[model samples]
Target: MSMRFGSRRQGRLAGAGVLAAATAGAALVAAPTAHAASVHVVTPGQSIQQAVDASRPGDIVQIMPGTYQESVLVNVPRLTIQGAGAQRVILKPPAAATAQGGAPKASTPDTPSTAGAASTPDTPSTADNAADVTPATTANPCFTTGTGICVAGTEGHRLKGVRIQGLTVTGFATYGVAATETDHLVVAGVNASGNKLYGIGEQKSVRAVFVRNHAADNGEAGIFLANTTQEEAGALDLDGARVSGNVLTGNTMGVVLRRVRDMDVLRNSVTGNCAGMFVIGDENTPRGGDLTIRDNEVSANTKYCAPNSHLPFVQGAGIVLTGVENTVVERNRIEGNVGTSQMSGGVVLFKSFVGVPNTGNTVRDNMLSGNAPADLADRDTAGKDNTFTGNSCSISQPAGRC
Candidate 1:
């Protein structure tokens, strides 16, 4: 079944203003300071944390090529932390620290689940919900928090204009990189792998960007964004947050955007995992939606994952959206994914665990092949105003959708 999707020129044209505003916001964050910013360089064997601590707002902390052992934290605003390159600069746990293994899981205030709802044996609670290592120190909270790098801010004083780039962070117990209550944050050209949970994660943040990065071999989602991991809450407006030009593989899921709105997931290569992408929402105020998933290559996500409290075992799922409204999925290349789970498909609209159905979503112009169950699966019969048109696929659930 081959059908031509209608032109989206009007939508693109209407969104130009929003894109411009987001670009301007990013520029303002990256603009040069009135006074020259200081640069602190750290070589191998030096304490990166010390350098970071010494830095003031708008300062640059440059890490030289070498393997370093220490967790770094950035709380100051307008700070730039850069490395020589992802290959040359590596951050791991301290030598005395024991290596933590197995997949990382997340426990809500009321219920427990793995990151993005995929799990395996020996899973530990995620950084946000888990207790810190013994003898946790206030001077460097990240040291015992099991996070390689953490940008932390309270709701009253959000961290703003922090940039992290060109580094490799791996082998941590929880997230390789994490941020909370942040604004105008940027993570670019980094490699985060071998972590127990998310490679990179952000919660309660807005106007964030993740670009040109590689995330692999993580136990959970390579990149995860959410409103709050600690408790159930309403979705947050992301102010045009974006995930683009990244390679995500060998994780439970490539990317998970949970309870967030006004975001873009574009031009990503996702494969070799249980699922490629998940857009999850629930019965809450300002339900997650108004996002775009476009121009991505998703394929061959055949890794098996065990069932969690929220979801059944998921494999070969390209993109799954639940309880979201007004979301657009278009112009993606999805193929070679095969599984029997209800969520498995090239593009699936599934019912939310809380019984909320998808609403006003669109799936169009995606090329799909070799997907089991069905390429286009509208599993949410109760969903409202969901449309499937202009797709190039041979099979779809309930027939005639392709």
Candidate 2:
């Protein structure tokens, strides 16, 4: 497992834990989710940032067809930002969003590829190159970190029915979706590609949902949901989140879920994406509740998705964990995920956990190939106290116990 690095840099404890909503629907769990609210329309000149600034809580901000060059920052809480269609509302900055501040720096040098390019032939190999492709997409194509598609901040944000489909989000400075100190976020039908930091950076966010999204050709990782915030004890800070029906490729990791609790990751496709799914806790913080990873297709992350990406000594894994507890890894197909780091196991449980040893987790009924199991069981786990049994490569990782 990687050493749990965050944007915080060389030093600092990453964050807190994930608080999941109870398992099952309303009948199975208490406190059901409310229905989505009504829609509000937006137009040109009326940029999304202005509307978000003007919108009241519980109101919706719907975007219309146009290239919204303005770098939008949403601080309002409990408001929805819906796009008419991915093709209609074109978000991003001209001349690179981050480059738009005042005048050009003049002396700044053009960096190499910010997003991963097809250099190493992994699989489904193609003879034609990036230059030959029609309507070519620029590498690291973000409008700019501060001036790209939808940069939402604060709490209770929602992005739905978006048509950010056909547009290319590239040449940005920061993150695609830089969500911090936020909750109840919903992002769907978005094609987030060619970003600087992360395609979607869900930092210190809670109760978020990412569905029907496509992320590719970005630097760093795709979908980075980290529990960087701490709630009161017994309150369960971040809880009951889900990532489903999405395509993650050509990024450091398909979906990196860290410090989340009681969440279910299901029905997603991670291919040609580096490190299909990464789960773990920070070095000494050592706390996150049950995570259920099931029923997904994970393959080829090494060839296309990651190709040659590496962070210092850590290579990558299809499903990797470091000091995580009370989790389930099952029903997922893991095949043909290749990595350079010799220790890149299909499923890895790093060194030992902090605080107490990681316990009460199960790994069963998971298919594996191109990679073998890292360890038969978690080294930090106490035998019998933590069940270790029933896993099939052809079946599901959580078929029984681990």
The numbered model that scores best in lDDT is 1
lDDT of 2 at 243: 81
Q: What lDDT is reached at residue 390 by model 1?
A: 95
Predictions in order: lDDT: 0.78, 0.51
Name model 1 segments beyond 4 Å from true.
1-34, 99-144
Per-prediction TM-score to the true structure, in the order listed: 0.85, 0.65
* Candidate 1 Cα RMSD (Å): 7.9
**By TM-score, how accurate is candidate 1?**
0.85
User: How does model 2 score by TM-score?
Assistant: 0.65
Over 1-402, each residue of candidate 2 has an lDDT whose tens digit, in order, gives 122223431111111000111111222134232643344667876656666667655556767767665455655555556664444555654434234342122111111111011222111111212221112123212222232544344344433212122232443444556565555666665656666556776655567777666677656566767654223112134567788777777777787765567788887878776577776553333455478989888876664332233232334467765546778888787776655553355665543323334456676777666653342324343322445455544322333323
